[model samples]
Target: MSPARVGRVAVLAAALGALAGAGAGWWVDPGGDGTRPALPATAAAGRPSSFAGADASWRGASPGLDAAHAAPSDLAARRTGAPRGAVGTPELQALLRAPPSALRASLKTAMRHRDQGGWLYARALARQCVLLEMTTLHEGTAGLAPVDLNQPLAQRVSAWREQLAAGCAQLQPEELREAMNVPAAASGTSATPGTLDGADPLIQLMDRPAPPGSAAARERLAAILNRADPLMLSELGPALLQREGEAFVFDGRRLAGEDERRALEAATMLLPCALGLACDERDERVWGPCVMTGDCRHATREEAVLAATDADAGLDAGPAAPDRRAAVRAWVERLREAVLARDVDRFLRPPG
Candidate 1:
């Protein structure tokens, strides 16, 4: 087979393998047997759980019950001014950015440190990785290819699965059991009745500020956006841009100023990719012609967006085809720059 054909075959195989693994309950229930009680419909809809109103102090509390008494690690001692549980350290960043081949070792290193929020951060990262892989598999099968032979992708899926299982094992039983007991009302989903599910841990954290208008809430939003991985961005960006009575809101307050407006526009353009990767796998806005034509040229969401024509409509509407594609490409570039710069402020600033 030609190299392109080989690539397509690999993707198809990976998708099948991933789907099979998911069916076997490896991906869906990595922590145990697939017998855990389903979260209430309200909770699944992103309503704040009954637990959302819990004391604000606990949200930022030391990770472990005895964490306060534990001596700081040499790494923690050296990083002055860093937040107690911050995950942005250079070492952790390196681990987060590590390739799949190196992921297991990186996860092991990340999971070893319980102080300074290392383990929590690691769990979040692992969970994100698993979700992203599942998204990739769905996209691959739905639009790109149709077969199960890719060893590398299968290995990656396996690695993330194992890491997630390891992370879950470290969680206290109560934490594991009660994490999703959040009530729909507390989720804010009860009030708005939107499709965005805030059940994901990172998304929950981003949306769970005690008093939504507080300075601490703003700081938390900025911190998470600044440090967010691509999957996190795909999930959180759209949630931040959610509309309420003629204005966009992040954490419930209307977006303020030109900077926030710019962020909203970027998030709007990001929706198709977000839908593909983090929201709805079956959304036609994400699938494009590949779903029908089976040509599968656009393997990635960026490619799909840039390849989109006026006929594709939706967000790609208004401007001429080339202009719309250019706009998306520009936003994609701006997003890349902001992520690389590691600054939410840069993300809000108008692109030069």
Candidate 2:
């Protein structure tokens, strides 16, 4: 393999490792309890993992997932029984054109036009959003009508969505206060740190139940988006749209002033590319000879990318970088507007 190929394979391996278990225990205690269960210790490494592609024969879907394979938000194109083909590059291009700020709104608006049952995952997942304090809207303790399967499927899906939406919308402000440790007034604050300039398509195709034969959607999606403008596609996906409804707005509570805009520009500069960290894969997975020893901690792929980007820019690695916090705030607010209002142009900005 050429040096570039070798490096790509190594970063792919490191990223795969991070996705598998690096963040498993990295979660916050959502309940604010002294009582949440502790994350299990990292398991002992088992058989050494290799990059050899598996046989296509072992690639079949699990029982219920065997139905259609369109991405969860493809409302008009029900996956009912379509054999999963490669996700269209154009579809990904459209996605990459979306910036982090508009991610949730873009998704929610798309959901409005969706065919029934297209986002089945949301039914079970909706209430959990509140417990996690993901709601910007209210959900109340009200009775929802029981479902009747004999009802037309659209009726059933619409009713379910309405119930979920109302529940999210009906929560008292106090509930948000009780749920999130952060102040209820600051709704735009992010729970996840380091994601603003972290990975692109943070999840890989293999990271999720991607259609059996598609390339990693994030990489393909990032490429098509940045091809013209060189920076798009930074938010998480339709899953957030399904559950949060209007509450899923990224963050539009306040606009950045001139100073804040300058801070945002600094933050945006720190991004590995407007394209995302996914484009910068290289052998540099942290400092001081750790990848060979396997004893390093604090060296997940996100850490590696941050370190590599800093090194490439002749920056240092100690405290957080300039505008790190501000960047996240700006990014979230950007998503808020796109998700809430019906402005498609917000989703189409050229990378700065």
Candidate 3:
């Protein structure tokens, strides 16, 4: 194989490794003091693990729209399905009723005790509210066709966010710094860091103005493509690519222009996979819809997507098929090659 092909293969291997087990233990709690039980060694190694110790029954239950309409206190009391010592009805009520400053303090306290189920759930809910607000803001500003916010899922997300934000209009600015344990002096005089800038160095690189198609820019692009998590790359890739007339511009610079067809193809293929990974990983962003809709029956986002589009559609709750897995691997490799070569035309092209 050529050197370029070899590198692409290496990138695919790394991505697969990441998907398999590199960060699989996020849900694991070795101490097992009832906050969460430790997964078995096999489970931690990327095998299908039973949710025996966790109150995961909540995932399969559909609390329905009426549940959404119920008072927060009533829902909290009825949904005692969280693990022991998870946030209780009283605490939930307090959080819902707390003033903005008090809520911020409560959330900060929750951050400290995230190992406990109740605190973790509270933090997760708060994060989801922020994510929904961000999504709404992005949709409004991106100059793209906005999604129907009136859709059931969209409505649920909006309602959940509005309910949460009633007490806490926004998260405290220092939350991320405190969570990441960054020194106060390092962040300088800014009370709030730029969201993307603070989160990842790669994002900072993307935000900077670089000469179009320069060697340094290509190198930076290559590093981002190769090093990014598959989920991150899949989501961020399209945002970086903008269609300008017949050509596409990446990061606001006109690189080699690609037609719209290929860009759409790439998005169509990669986005669902990213969504699946997000839901499978139980990401906090998905928690809002899951909790609000109370239709967490789908274990994977792919399943959720299927059910949304076609109510009768069903997916096996087992591992993905070998061919589907192979397609994802090939897609990632293609993306890596496109980035390394600085060729937008090949970015989402399927491997020959």
Candidate 4:
């Protein structure tokens, strides 16, 4: 077989192996034979129940579960007068700009201290490290010819599986979102091609005057959000990333897991509405005014990213809703093409 053929086999084997890993992670009810409770998120996390630095007082980082303790909103989190100081700092900018492999050593460092825990940034960075590790599995396993057919594939597969299982053990869905910077909600889906070129929310937001002035606005928004929901925008990331995966399948590759598929549609809506990003004409269908897009709502509705009022009132997920899955699917296809084309500049911009 050619090297490409061998690599394809390795990737397939890795996916199947992950299924086994997933199954093993589920817990059997203590008394109920085959049933389990719906609320066992921690039990379902399938790794250590305790989050790293979960107990520590972290500084200058975006709020984690730990942030709920005092004030992630507290200015004291910073020493110098930086708004977020170290927390908001993109520690991985250098690595993200580098190849995917460069993340491995840093991931190892995060994983080692993941439990011992130190900085809130380290804990937050570890969450991204876990995700990066998952990507590397795909990148590393995507190609390779096993020199000896006699070698048990488990040797190659088990180690990586174990690593991912441990790293993501007790990983919450929200942590996944902030790491990717994918929106949990957006302001509108009616974004036209012309508007998206300049109207991408992040781009638009960046163009505004610097904070303290503008930052003061966000702080005010944060206070309103704390009253409305103290945990602001954490869960939004995972929902967006998962649903976006369905929209982003490429070269026959796709994302899976029931937890991932659940709430995909609602989360998809949030992208254009909450994040102020462009909607590909396709996603234009998957979300909109609640009356029209109600059918597109993910059935399970268990893992909500942002609350309904928050998504609608704050982010504006309600607007022209979908006619069919074809909408989001089409948008995803366009995104896949862009990524394959290495259109980094166009990632947040609406696809053609």
Of the two candidates 2 and 3, the one with more favorable TM-score, higher being better, is: 3
Order the candidate numbers by lDDT, best to worst: 1, 3, 2, 4
TM-score of each: 0.38, 0.20, 0.33, 0.21
Model 2 segments more than 4 A misplaced: 1-305, 318-322, 336-343, 349-352
Q: Top lDDT: which candidate number?
A: 1
Query: lDDT by residue for model 4 over 181-283, one digit each (tens)?
Result: 3222321133421244223232222222323324443443232222221011122222212124345322233445332243233333332222111111111
Q: Write the per-residue lDDT of candidate 2 for residues 1-352, one digit (tens) a residue.
A: 6454344334333333333332222222223442221121211110001102212321232111122222334433333321122122223323222222232332442324322211111211222223222111112313212334353432323333333344334333333222222121222123232232221222221123323113433333333333222112221221222112222211332223543433333222222222222111110122111212222332223333333333333444545554443353344344333432434333332223
Give per-residue CA lDDT, model 1, range 38-157, as digits (tens): 111010000001111222322232221121222223343433222223223534433433333333454455555533224433443444333333444456453233323243323333
The local distance difference test score of each candidate is 0.36, 0.27, 0.35, 0.26
List candidate 1 stretches off by more than 4 Å.
1-90, 96-102, 113-145, 148-207, 210-217, 225-234, 246-296, 305-319, 332-352
lDDT of 3 at 86: 25
Cα RMSD, each candidate: 16.0, 23.6, 19.2, 21.4
State the displacement of the C-alpha of residue 348, model 4, in Å, after optimal TM-score superposition.
Answer: 20
Report backbone clashes per prediction: 11, 15, 2, 21
- Model 4: residues >4 Å from true position, as ranges? 1-121, 124-159, 162-352
Whose TM-score is higher: candidate 3's or candidate 4's?
A: 3
Candidate 3 lDDT, 168-281, residue by residue in tens: 444443452233232332222233323322233332333434354455545555544543333333324354444445454533344442322333333333442331122332
TM-score of 3: 0.33
